[model samples]
Target: MSEISNNDDIRTILLPSAPFGIPEVTANDAEGTWGLRRLGVPHPDVYAMADIVSCTVRELECEGTAGPAVGEARGMELLGEVLKNPGKVARANKYKGGAYCGGVYLEVTLRDPTADKLIIPVWGRELKRGSMAYRQVIESAETVKAAFDEMIEGGSRG
Candidate 1:
């Protein structure tokens, strides 16, 4: 196979904005150029390429969090139910030493033109895990819905 390029053919899965950009992810594959912008702190203890099914999602392993991955799964499950077309979610692989790390990632096959209608919402919170004015909030379908609702209702404040 040819090496992934920085072009549209590369599958750049767009995932929920990472909290505080602690665990930033980038990709250059058949889907296009994808990136996960983290919005918080608490740098990950470990970072690696995760093979979920046949696609790859960035695995962010942080210390002090235990359920981002699970929360993301539940949220995606809820979102899929709401959308009526189960969408795949990227999660941190605990089996690969990511137990303490909460994760967020993009699906490799989210490149179909029609799939553009599936919009992944974004949000923010007080930074947690440090002495700052931010906090780490769980990334779930509900959070995305709430965040999108807030954005549609009246944009963001922080």
Candidate 2:
């Protein structure tokens, strides 16, 4: 076989001293999973948002930083709690709220080892990895920390 063809080139980009780049690349993160994974992402884009979520979680600590929620909630219920009355929105299937000015039609399925996954539906920030919008999303320490604290903590049955 011919030498394995290598075409991928490694390049580094430097920002032009602007206040973070913008949503130059856009994709619908319907579940916010892709955005959340950046919390643990290993990309070295330098501009990559690996710690976007985790960093905010740490910064948003209260006097007594709590753990994840030790309970379960459906998508609608979680949305209602955040929205303070889903009104007619709760009964809907698809949430396209994020489309309104960088908002995300956020849906999250949380899991506990001893419990099932909790589906949370909320209208929150839309995070695009390496985008300034994502940078702003993580700036709110309270929101991130609260999300972390509300996570359900489960114990192994072993």
Candidate 3:
């Protein structure tokens, strides 16, 4: 086997980034194209990309009403439905106290015609409603939207 060194297949692009917008700007605030932000004051709640990541749902087998084909559905899609409509929650025992107990997550499924199913996990800050986990009342789905935006704009990189 010989060397496969090629630079043509690689490229770079520059995007505008700033600490913060005028109105939102504080003495030490910032924001990146990827939804990264450093805010001035603490508002009720604002969503932003918590941690950017993605994966795929591989084929599997099982049994149930939705009966048994792992690859048939995308994990990301399931995550979305879970978040869109909060239900069936499990506590995070390992983590600290009551607050972190019943946390929620969103899985966004993404894929191309010939590409494998891409599953993206979106995490959010939720408010505890009795025993249920709900997004912070003041929180918007901005984080979910931002993450998806990154996937769309970043493409393979996302």
Top-lDDT structure, candidate number:
1
For this target, which candidate reaches the highest TM-score against the unseen true structure? Answer: 3
Q: Tell me the lDDT of model 2 at 45.
A: 20
55-158 in candidate 3: lDDT tens per residue? 22221111221333222346896566557643321222212233332223333333333544322222223334343323331132244334344544555443
Off by over 4 Å in 1: 1-19, 22-98, 106-108, 111-136, 139-142, 145-158
**Stretches > 4 Å off in candidate 3:** 1-104, 107-111, 123-133, 137-141, 150-158
What TM-scores do the predictions have? 0.19, 0.19, 0.22
Q: Candidates sorted by lDDT, descending order?
A: 1, 3, 2
**lDDT for every model?**
0.32, 0.27, 0.29
For model 2, give the 10-residue run with minimal summed lDDT.
10-19
lDDT of 1 by residue, 1-158 (tens): 01213355332222423553332333433322234444454332111122211232233435323555433456567566446632222223332343332343323323244533322222222222332221232333233333223322331221
Alpha carbon lDDT at 53, candidate 3: 40
Cα-based RMSD of candidate 3: 18.7
- Summed backbone clashes in each candidate are 27, 6, 5
Please give the ranking of all candidate structures by TM-score, highest first, separated by commas: 3, 2, 1
